[model samples]
Target: MKKLFFVGILAALFVGTTNVSAMTEADLRKKFDETVTINGNKYAVSDGDKKLADDYLAKYEVSSDDCDYIAKKIDEAKAILTAEGQEDLTKLSESTKTKLKKLVSDVSANTSVKGTVTSGSVVILNSDGSTFAEVTSLVKQTGTERSNIAIIAGVAFVITLVGACLVVKQVKNSNN
Candidate 1:
């Protein structure tokens, strides 16, 4: 019974320590929202600018349907912006236009949206079909954890070496 309990505890510890990549749609949405909020706060925008950005960003709700919804939306936006002439949409700063165009280009490359967009407002694409936000976040966390483990291991090795040296010195002194 005691051996079974020990095995159970070891199993539980292994299970608890395993990395999990479980992410829900709501979690992805929150990450998107937090990113937008951070960017929004990072720069100063007028009410009108904020409203425009909000409206533009709101159009993208991540869908798992695997349809070409992103391409369609980009085309629609482009058509609307360039309908008459480029002059009319001059109010959209060159930087914003460049960013949006880059975003559209990125989204266009991915035929399927396996996971949600990250960092870039609404339509950023991760080439591998895995989520950029979640994957990067996990990678960073794992890197930190690995670094911590390495540091702990180094400290333990040093302590053990020092203790062994002390023991050896004590034996030599006793023999003398």
Candidate 2:
């Protein structure tokens, strides 16, 4: 009888302590949007140029790594244009095309894209594992700052869990 009563009380206490407002898909999406926005302004290629590159690859034989390299080069070209006070890239001038051609040829002779360039779309997944993978990828792309944030978040979660357990134990002790 005592064991059953104790179990019942424990279940009740746990149920009462359950958080009603936990993280939702919307929250994750919001964060994704923010991250993508910030990264895009910082290092991403223009959407129009990205589309053109994608279309070009659709009709060409290209390795994944080569495609990534090409995309990176395209973004670099866009960065140069932005730096030169040329925001619009409606038409590629002969000089610009010549420069980009040289870049492409140079890149083709070397390695493919490897590091996280912080110049991609935001991806959110339905499953927890997939979401975690996306978060890991994002952290990698964002570099050390986000990695530190992830570590701190993990520590805070552990602390919160431990604090909750202690509170439950204290409540049970008080009841006794």
Candidate 3:
């Protein structure tokens, strides 16, 4: 009875906290309209762009080594968000891509895109475990910073598709 009561209480606490904390459309709109100040200049921040920073922030703590790097990336992110810069989204994407291409390798490189086939086929599954933060922090301290690449996720999904085909081949081989 005591155990059940404690479990119920814990469940209620978790549920109560998460339920009301979930943001609604109004809350998201308010967040979108928010401004963030950097280097004495205030810039409007989009909720989506902030989410990108937040994705990095999740893994980042305030560290002397990372403070400057993270801060710099945060600044770049602000530029991207501008909330709106030159009115050229394509230009923004290209610049970020150029800077990151040298520093960041393809994220899906280690993921198995190919498997061997004998009389039987082998199954290979490749998935990207790195979050955007890890990707941003990809070579940190050992620190190689990748300016966010807009097409990286799309590329990763395509790479994963090759592995997905391998899985199908394996399934067919096993059935035979």
Put the candidates in TM-score order, highest first. 3, 2, 1
**Given candidate 2, what's the lDDT at residue 74?**
47
lDDT string, candidate 3, 145-164, tens digits: 44345468668889999999
With candidate 1 superimposed using the best TM-score fit, by how many Å does residue 68's alpha carbon deviate from the native?
Answer: 18
- lDDT value, candidate 3, whole model: 0.33
Candidate 1 or 2, higher TM-score? 2
lDDT of 1 by residue, 23-91 (tens): 454543342232111112221223332333333234333333323445344444434334423332324
Model 2 residue 147 CA deviation in Å? 65
TM-score of each: 0.22, 0.25, 0.26
lDDT of 2 by residue, 1-176 (tens): 00111111111111111112343535423322221112123323333323332332233333545545644654565454444443233333556545644553445354331111111222212223232111112123545988899999999999999999999999999999
- CA lDDT scores, all candidates in order: 0.36, 0.36, 0.33
For model 2, state the Cα shift of residue 80 in Å.
0.8
- Tell me, what's the RMSD of every candidate? 22.0, 25.9, 21.4
Worst 10 residues of 3 by lDDT: 1-10
